[model samples]
Target chain A: MVALEFWFEFASTYSYPAAARIQAMADQAGLTVVWQPFLLGPIFQRQGWHDSPFNLYPVQGRYMWRDLERICAALNIPLRRPSVFPRNSVLAARVACAFAAEPWLPDFVRQVFHANFAEDLDITKPDIIQTCLERSGISGHRIIERALAPDNKDALRLQVERAVALGIFGAPSFLAADELFWGNDRLEQAIAWCKVPSLVGIA
Target chain B: MVALEFWFEFASTYSYPAAARIQAMADQAGLTVVWQPFLLGPIFQRQGWHDSPFNLYPVQGRYMWRDLERICAALNIPLRRPSVFPRNSVLAARVACAFAAEPWLPDFVRQVFHANFAEDLDITKPDIIQTCLERSGISGHRIIERALAPDNKDALRLQVERAVALGIFGAPSFLAADELFWGNDRLEQAIAWCKVPSLVGIA
Candidate 1:
């Protein structure tokens, strides 16, 4: 079976739809997904961007929200526009990294995405992150405590560095071996590439 | 039949593929294609960007070139990397706008794209644009002369302003009624939206 890394940012609007469908879609293609959660804030800072590109360019931002609305509707996913353009996702990302090895990590990611994009809840709040964790059948308090550990914090930071080293500027990005495919629309293309070993020269 | 406006910039890499396939695809889908040629340089300048976003962000830039390579190969289209990151497309765009009402405008647009991206020719040169025009079976010198006319120059400028008024920040964008879909990947979705009359409330 081919293994693919799904690099996602909790604050990314497009990542919501990708996180919701990737696991099930990967399973059907007989691909194994290594869910890698990282922070996009540090990455954006390196690129000299203080805010999301959607917010920095007003017209593009306007188009993105409408595009996201249409896409979510087509996917049968309910969307509730968040009051904030990009909610602080540090806590959510850290907790995600804390439970990176857990089998239910994907579930946790999806729920957190839902909390931010569908429920219009603040993802930065510990209470909200915990609620997302608990809803995913994980021990919210325990994981949140572990996630706040210095080592886990360092681990999350390292993950962000890894994303930068891999030349990823956006989420959700897919990596089949060393090849990177960005955007929610590229998800199917990434899967197709993974399934066809020749595409990645794996065969 | 439903109608869609295809807003494109000559220097846009993604627009090359869209321009090559849009007319045929629209025809097969029983939709009318309104080719809107405009310059993205002015639009980018308004957002404080003096260059392509692909160039403004290095990592994204690298990924885009690689992504375009793969996409073109998948589509079985020839791609020649231009010596310049973005060749001045002013001349090509003006010529396209000049022939906007002509029956062979789509063919002329495709040839210009073919010249710039596929053939690595400078689209800014009148000789090159003229060549593209002649190859499309249109009068090269006459069209080139008309394209450089003062009135045609103002017409192209007006089109760029019109694009901004329509909330278009990139190309190639598809507009079905009031709905805007950006990117080549959204082509089929835009077509589908146009085909389903109820989606546009025409039914």
Candidate 2:
């Protein structure tokens, strides 16, 4: 089975749906899912944006919320409007980064997305992410400690760099055989590309 | 047959594919295709943007080209990189607005998109738009004269304002019973929404 890299940002509005349903979709297609958690702040900063593009453009931001509401409802996923747009996701990414190699990382990532988007909880706070870690059946205290460690912080930073190197400007990006697909809407297409790399004429 | 309003801008990159395929797809789905040609320049101005968002954000701009290449390839559509990022579309839009009530409007719109994207022609030029109009079997000279009339110019302006009133922030947007779906990727979903509006819980 070809390995598909699922590059996501904890604060991405679209990533919530992709993170919620990607694993099962990948499993059914007999593809190896590599869960990659990264932050978009650095990437946005590199693009000279101090905040989310949605915030910068009010019209686009308004449309995005309505679109997200309809999409979540269609997917039968619970989504509460977050109080903050693009919440500080450094901590959440670090935790996921600390456990990227573990089998439970996907579940933990989904839990974080759910807690933030479904519950409207602030993910920047340590306790909220701690709760997500616990719900995923992982040691919350040990993982949080490891996640906040200097080494883990550096690891997470490099992960963002990797996303940049791969030309991922937005979240819920999928990398299949070196071809990049951005946005949650492209998830199925990405999986299809993984299933048959030649179909897209990607050499 | 249900009517699906295809709201597009000549300057919009994604609108190329949507315009090219929308009529045939809608005909197959037994839906009426309403070709709405509006300008995105005023819409972008209202959003405090003077240029395309893709150009404003370089990384996104770069990814857009690559993504467009793959997408056009997958759809078997010929695409040439336009020398200009977003050619001025006011002239072309006015022409569209002038003859929108005519039956051959959709074909003319598709021809214009093909000229801009596939042939890399400058659509802002009267001669080029004239060529598209001739290809669609319309009187190029007469229509061009009517299109540049002051009333037709104002008509195009009001069309843009109507787009803003409808809360449309991007091109290639579909309006089915007032529910908006943005992006070419959502074209089929928009058609589905039109076919079964109640299933999406849109009242």
Candidate 3:
């Protein structure tokens, strides 16, 4: 089975849904999903946005929240509007980057999203991410130490650079053999593209 | 059955697919699709985007064109990258707005899209839109006169304002009553919302 690279940012609202459901969907289609966690701050800044585009344009932001609510309702996922619009996820991303190949990375990803979006908790604090790590069935102390190490932080920075090289401009992007599909809405289509690489591509 | 309002801008690439396929999908769902032609220029300007966000941000633009190619290929719709990235569609939009209630408005919409995307013709010109009108089985001369009328022009401006008021920041947006769905990707979900409004919405 071909691998689908699931590139996501922890602070992205759309990535929350993509993180929650991508694995099961990919498994059914016989695709292996590579959970790529990266920060959107540098990426957005490169595109001349100092903040989430949603916050910059409140009208689109309003529609986005409404759309997200509908999507969450359809999927039966619990969501609460985060008190802090987009919580800092640098340390969380570093943890995921440091252990990208871990068997329990997916669980940790979901747990962090749950903390921020489902529970409306501030994910930036070390204690919250520590709780998330514990919830993902891993002891928090050692991972947090390694996650804050210089090497892991550098790895996370490079991950954002690599994402830009692959033409990913937003979170919840899927890369199937260099074909990029953006947004949670394209996850199923990305899975299908992996299933039959020839059927739905022009490149 | 509830009605689904399709809001489109002629220069929006995703709107091409939505315009081509929305009518049939709405028909199957026993829903009436009210075609709304609006300009995205004023809306984007208000949001501080001087050009199509796709163009202003080239990475996203690259993905969009490739994604559009994939979609058009999958749907067996002919596509050619227009010489202009986003050809001006003000006049075409006015033509659409002017004759929106006519039975042939849908055909005219498709023709204008084809002229710009498939045929690589300038849709902003009077001749091009007149050709589109004739292809839709309507006489072009008087309609162009009416479309270019000051009142019709103002109506198109008001349409864009109405779109902004509804929190629409992008093209190919669907409204099931007051709920908004953005992008061609959401067309199916929007239709589903129209079909069984309660099952797929929080609003």
Interface RMSD of each: 5.7, 4.4, 4.3
The reply for model 1, stretches above 4 Å from the true place, is: A197-203, B197-203
From the highest lDDT down, the ranking of the candidates is 3, 2, 1
Off by over 4 Å in 3: A199-203, B199-203
lDDT of each: 0.88, 0.88, 0.89
Name the top lDDT candidate.
Answer: 3
Candidate 2 residue-wise lDDT at B100 = 94
Docking class of 1: acceptable
Among these predicted structures, which one has the highest DockQ?
3
TM-score for candidate 3, residues paired by index: 0.97
The DockQ scores of all candidates, in the order shown, are 0.44, 0.46, 0.56
Better of 1 and 3 by lDDT: 3
Candidate 1 i-RMS: 5.7
For each candidate, give its TM-score against the true structure: 0.96, 0.96, 0.97
Q: Which of the two, 2 or 3, has more lDDT?
A: 3
